[model samples]
Target chain A: MVELLAQTGLNAVYAASYISLVAVGLVLIFGVMGVVNFAHGELFMAGAYAVVALYADMHVPFFVAVAIGMAFVGLLGLLMEWALFRPLKDNPLGGLVASIGFLMILQSLAVMGFGVRMEHIPPVTQEVVRFTDKVGLPVARLYVIVAAVVFLSALWYFLKRTRFGWALRASAQDPEAAALQGISITQTARIAMFIGAALAGVAGALTAPLVSVNPHMGHSVIVTAFIVIIVGGVGSLEGAILASIAYAFVHTFVTTFWDGVLADIVGLSLMLIVLIVKPTGLFGSADRA
Target chain B: MRNFLILLVGLAALIALPHGLSFSQQEILVFLVINVLLVTSYRLLTLTGEWSLGHVVIMGVGAYSSALYTKELGVYVPVSMLLGAVTAALLAVLLSFPLFRMKGFYFLIGSFAAGEIIRLIWKRFREPFGGVRGISGIDPMPDFSVGFYQFDFFEPVSYYYFAGAIVIACLWILWRIEKSPVGLTFHAVHWQDKLAQASGVNLRAYRTLAFAIASGFAGLAGALQGHYVGTVNPNSFDIEVMVFVLTWAIVGGTATFYGPILGCIVLTVLNEIVLREMGLEQARPLIYGAIMILSILFLPNGLESLVQKATRRKTTAKPEEKAAT
Candidate 1:
């Protein structure tokens, strides 16, 4: 029983890592651009497809594929900002609708490119690090966990120690005030979109081999990300991370104990309860709420 | 008199519309008529300044319940459909407790989560919802002759007319509601809720009322669809369907009652006729997505704005003639 609990804990940690990566990016884009970016999960799927095209199809190095995938999805994010979100800046609902359109396009493109069938990608490594005879963690999952921690730490550093970070944070707080301070709203928006999209991309690329990669995979992913972000607080980065961890633990435990469908129900119920109790979210800003 | 004449001509055209179509095209028309109701009902909710992602699920609730009512309780088909709408409305009122707490973006996500839970529940319970497979082989509306016309349930043309009548009736009610004082309060709640509240409007009650009414109509549409298709499944009312409703409303411009209906008809025609004829049916979603993006960018106010623009020009021209006369 102790071993089962420990194994579940480790699994939850892995789930939390990827979830936070996606949720953080969503929060950053929402915070900076003030758009929901509903195509976010598709951006994550785009990254996994990037890996499928590179590492799986072209035999590129795994790390090289991941890096390229991240950069590629970041550029897609930039395109979204320029083509969709930027024009719809004043209309948040329009931005969301446009993102949904983009999402459909991405899914259709994937279907056209890869067919509807799941692509089987060769594993990065087969070695498992055994904590005990009964408990084991795959090296591939460890790669995802490590990359999440490193990228998140690097993102934290960028958002805190740098001048660009200050500008990003400033604009997120108040775009007009930041604009008065000579911070380019457009520039900050582009930076935030790229970073936000790239995080989701990298997470998808990292977990591409661990999970089945398919055209419709983003649906569940986006739902989970939405639940996490809502629970964490819509626009709070720290809250997103904390909520992701909390949600991941609960979801993973429920899945382990009962079933996937029940876990989903529980997670959604939790989000609804949170919404009723605190519309601002656990760590959300009062002013924004 | 001119407006009444136009409406008569429009009704005549709608009645005559399906006769010119091929069998498959006629089938598409039936779905199109049903979708018209679905999108219009969605517009009703948007009037109160709230957009729900769960509208499709509420529609599904109607479909599932109506199907169950007929299958299990052995209720009459028409009565079962009404009960289904009532069920959906009641569900919306219940959901409002948790959902109404959030506004704007939060409401959007909250509604989505609530919808997903309902869908998941349908997926989880095999006894009632048939698990993931959903309740299939739903009871169809019984055939009956109406003196001048024999109302057959199997023919798409007959179904189209029957569904069209219900939809038209629903639209009439919806239009009346929109034009009434209650609707004005809804718009007031949307544009300036704080002021609406200051004016002694019970904002919560109004929002809930709009939501329930919208959901009731959506449920009716769903029940109509289930009876036509003879199946009710979880996937049938998923987010993708909701997205289609959203796009229709957005592309149609929800400012006018006719906007969303126009958007639905135009897009459905574009999708079914144009894409199907070109044998690019597989690329339909891609083209639809492109259209959605392009419309949002260029035609932000929707196809209705174009209609309004042309009408404005004619109406503006008419004033000069009136002065000359």
Candidate 2:
């Protein structure tokens, strides 16, 4: 029982890693750009497809493929900002609607580019690290977990230790005030959009081999990301991380013990309960609610 | 008198509209009519200054419940649909307890979570809810003979007319509600909740009222679709459908009652007739997406704004003559 529990715990940790990566990116975009990019999940999908194209189909090195994927998705994010969000900046709802439009376009393009069938990328590695006779962690999953930690730490350091980070934070907190201080809102928005989208891309690229990559695969993970961000607070990065971990544990345990659908219900119900009990999320201060 | 004449002509045109279409087009017409009701109900909810992502799921509540009433208990189809709508309204009231606690973006996310939970429940349960496959072989509306026309359940044109009549009646009721003092209160709550509260308006109650009423109508729409399609599935009421509703409302401009209806019709005509005629079914979503983005970017006020503008010009130009007439 203990071994089984440990295995589940490890699995939950892995889930937490990717979930936090996605949620943090969502939070950052919402915070900095003041728009919910509904196309975000599509950016992640685009990243995964990038890997499928470059590594699986074209024989590129795995890490090189992931890097290109991340860059490509970040570029997509930049395109969205320039084409949609920037023009609709004054109207947040308009921005959201436009992002939804972008999402459909991306999905349709995916369907056109690579048919609707799920693509199973060949496994990157075949090794698993065994902690015990009954517990092991696959190397692919470990790559995701390690990459999440490294990227998140780097992001944390950037936000705290860099001038661009300070400018981004200032703009997120008070765009007008930041503007008064000569911090260009457009520059910060571009930076935030790029980084936010790249994080989702990397997460998707890293997990491409682990999950079935499909045009509609974004739907489920986007729901999971929404749950995490809402539970963590809309604009709080640390809150997003914590909420992702908590949600991952709960969802993993529920799925392990019961079923995936039930796990989804439980996760969503938990989010609803949090919204009812604390409308600003567990750690959110309602800065931009 | 002029307004009445216009309305009569519009009604006549709608009645004549489906006859010129092919069989598949007539089928699209039925779903289009049903969607008109759905989008309009969604507009009613937005009037109270709250936009719910759960509106479609609530519609599903009506569909599932109505289907169950007919399938499991053998209730009359028409009566079961009403009961299904009532059930949805009651469910909205219950959900409002937790949902209305948040406002704006929080409310949006909360509604989405609440909706996902409902859909997941339907997917998880197999006994009554029919699990992932959903309830199939639903009871269709019974055939009947009117004085002038024989109604059959099998023909898309028949179903279109049937659904069209119900939708028109629902739209009329919705219009009446929107024009009433309660509707004024709803607008008041949306535009200035603090002021409305100071003016002795119960904000929560009004929000809940709009939500319940809108959800009830949405349920009716769902029930109408279920009977026509002869099936009810969880996937049918998913977020993708919700996005379509949002797109219609947003692209139509929600300031006027006719706006979303106009948007829904125009977009449906474009998507169904033009896209299909061109043999670009695969590129349909792509073009639709491009249109959505273009409209938001360039025509942020929506297609209705153009109509409003044209009317404003006509009214301004012919004020004296119009008044004299």
Which candidate leads in lDDT? 1
lDDT of 2 at B47: 93
Tens-digit lDDT track of model 2 for A51-150: 9999999989999999999999999989988998888889868888898899999999999999999997999999999999999999999999999999
Best by DockQ: 2
Candidate 1 residue pairs in backbone clash: none
lDDT of 2 by residue, B84-131 (tens): 999999999999999999888888988999999999999999988999
Off by over 4 Å in 2: B317-325
Docking class of 1: medium
Interface RMSD of 2: 0.9
State model 1's lDDT: 0.94
Model 1: residues >4 Å from true position, as ranges? A286-289, B318-325
Number of clashes in every candidate structure?
0, 0
For residue B242, give model 1's deviation from the true position in Å.
0.3
Per-residue lDDT of candidate 1, residues A1-289 (tens digit): 9999999999999999999999999999999999888999999999999999999999999999999999999999999999999989887688999999999999999999999999999999999999999999999999989988999999999999999999999999999999999999999999999999999999999999999999999998999999898888889999999999999999999999999999999999999988889877888874453
